[model samples]
Target: MTQESQAAEANASGNDNLLLQAAAPLLNAVVQLRQAVTHDDPAGLRQSLIDEIRQFEQRCKQAGLPFEMIIGARYCLCSALDEAAAQTPWGTRGVWSGNGMLVTFHNESWGGEKFFQLLSRISQSPNQHLWLLEVVHYCLLLGYEGRYRGSDSGRVQCDAIRKRLAKLIEETRQPQSESARPLVEVHPLVSSISRPMIPLWACATVAALLACLLYSALNWRLGNDAEPLLRAIYQTPLPQITVGRRPSSPQALLDLRQRLNDVIAAGQLEVSDGAFGSKVIIPADKLFAEQGTAINPVGRALLARVATAMKNVKGTVLVSVFTDNRPVDNSRFASSYEFSFARARAVTQLLQSQLADGHAIRSEGRGDSDPLLPNDSNENRTRNRRVEITLFAAPETLSNHQGTQ
Candidate 1:
């Protein structure tokens, strides 16, 4: 395949990964809880599942958001989550980007508690499929050979579940005209309300309910401990972003995406469309030696290729560096923020000499504050440690600090 095709494929795959990460927690929980369905004494597993679900709920609290986690139900908790989505790590755009998912379940099998924790991870990625949880759950019921497959976990093997699956398949095969009721139900998120209410009370009701929902969902008051979880979301990917002043057109974003893909190695970097024009994500390891400010030889070579690619592209170039939520124990810089800023400046310097004078560049240091994923595992931490360079379509966006330093 061509380099551009490869880049497109990688971006699609990366977004899928973002969705999978979001869906894993709640999906695992629900799938596990479903496993307990076969046990004569499921209380043990049920209680354990509750504890895990509660942990995710607490983490949401740590993020300063309260969401409903229905323990066991057969329908998607769509609107409840839609309302709580804004306070989520990725916001509403992060929530699978599907207006209505789970439209193809074809049966009463539901994705609930076990899948809720994963919902946030799914939201973290762009253009995510909302139906992933349902697909995973449906496959589990069919005895699919995957981790979430219910057969391996003992839930799908029981005579009752087997009989139920057989019946579901038979019903799914029936012609819609011959069936008494439609096999598919529209997911609640996109389904219209049954009745109308006054707009005035809706605002007051939402305001009143938010407090009660948070209090009821969390039960006890938060102590002084959850402070570290709530940090400001990084907003300066572009220098000064004013709405309609960017991206000459949607086609402009597409062309920029293709151009970057031609020069940057697909495996080495990530390329995608952004609110600006195009955004490229490169791992810090690819750009710098460990704990050093200067760009390594390999990094310099990659940046050189990037500079050559955008030589004629006129736009605002921003080099934003981020650090994982780890202490800068032995680094020369005092903290992660300083270290990130220093690297951004170093990378920006390399690109300035090669690009045309019309292209403006600025460096931004976004410490451990803005992360794509929670800094929980070594793999996650590594993913969070990276650099972002955004090329805004609008020219002359930066008025100050054009290229000082």
Candidate 2:
């Protein structure tokens, strides 16, 4: 195959692999959720909900997706739903708001009939289908609605997800055939008298109920010293990808080390052999402007050299950025993680721009979560603010070597 074609094929394969990886956990979570709801076990339902959301959050991070986890929202509580709805008076609605990604759940009333109806809708609605697609989109390394940029694993993953979304969008837009009901259809109102609002005094009826639920939720969380879980109907997790044996044959390992050494010798970065692979650290002061994601001229030059050195390696490169625990509230970034992610993405873009083929590169922002040094000292905090790049043999490359052996 021509070099370009080979690169294209490798990228497409990687994309599919990542998507399938993310989907595995999600499918399992969905099944568990469906089972919990079907059996009417509220405790199991709540636990499953937490497990699934945590998985989604982790998968999004691993896959390099953009959506943030709303940790403060009490997602699995029926009380949150009731309170949100009760405020509306005439029936009620619950919407996944804040982020432009809106998820609307149809729970007209919190009665026995509505409970069963909600369960039925979740199991058999286009809304659920659309929701799955959205989760996958957000789980993708690419931002939602991103296009295929070509010849990279991350781009390929984005491409595959975009295609899936296109198919879903089309399916959602087309007129429903006779066999398939519209996912969400307006119900016919039989009579106005049949649908009556709760009396104003009835608001008092829920006051005690709401207070009890709030107290219980707070106590449960405070007792455990854990964050309260939110009660939302959307979100899920993807499965983990199994890594192959490391391709660290003595000769190859030596060659890779020598290349890293050559760069380290130039004084632009630091390199050390890590447990899993070779770790390359580039100081943020060198790669980025103060509080910026844009690469400086010096940063671009260093990345170009690193990319050139790594172009022929049959491996994937993970470029992740880390930041100190300093508060980022006054800045444009909403959180430290967002700031770190932007810097990582900026570095990845520069590296990819210089690379021609063979090296598979992706980026992640770890935020202030994984600090390398104690944050108590300014020098230590400064040490924590750096970008780390690591190299690992692609699974296919390792598999091919084993096959030859």
| Top candidate by TM-score | 2
Reference-based TM-score, model 2: 0.43
Q: Tell me the deviation in Å of residue 351 in model 2.
A: 1.3
Q: Model 2 over residues 67-170: C-alpha lDDT tens digits?
A: 31222111212222332222332212122111111111111112212222222233345433443343343322222212222224645554654566556645
lDDT score, candidate 1:
0.49
Cα error of candidate 1 at position 84, Å: 40
Q: Give one digit per residue, the lDDT tens place, for model 1 in 31-106.
A: 3333332344333433453454455444433433223212111123222222222223333232222221221110
Candidate RMSDs in Å, in order, are: 21.3, 19.7
Cα error of candidate 2 at position 69, Å: 9.0
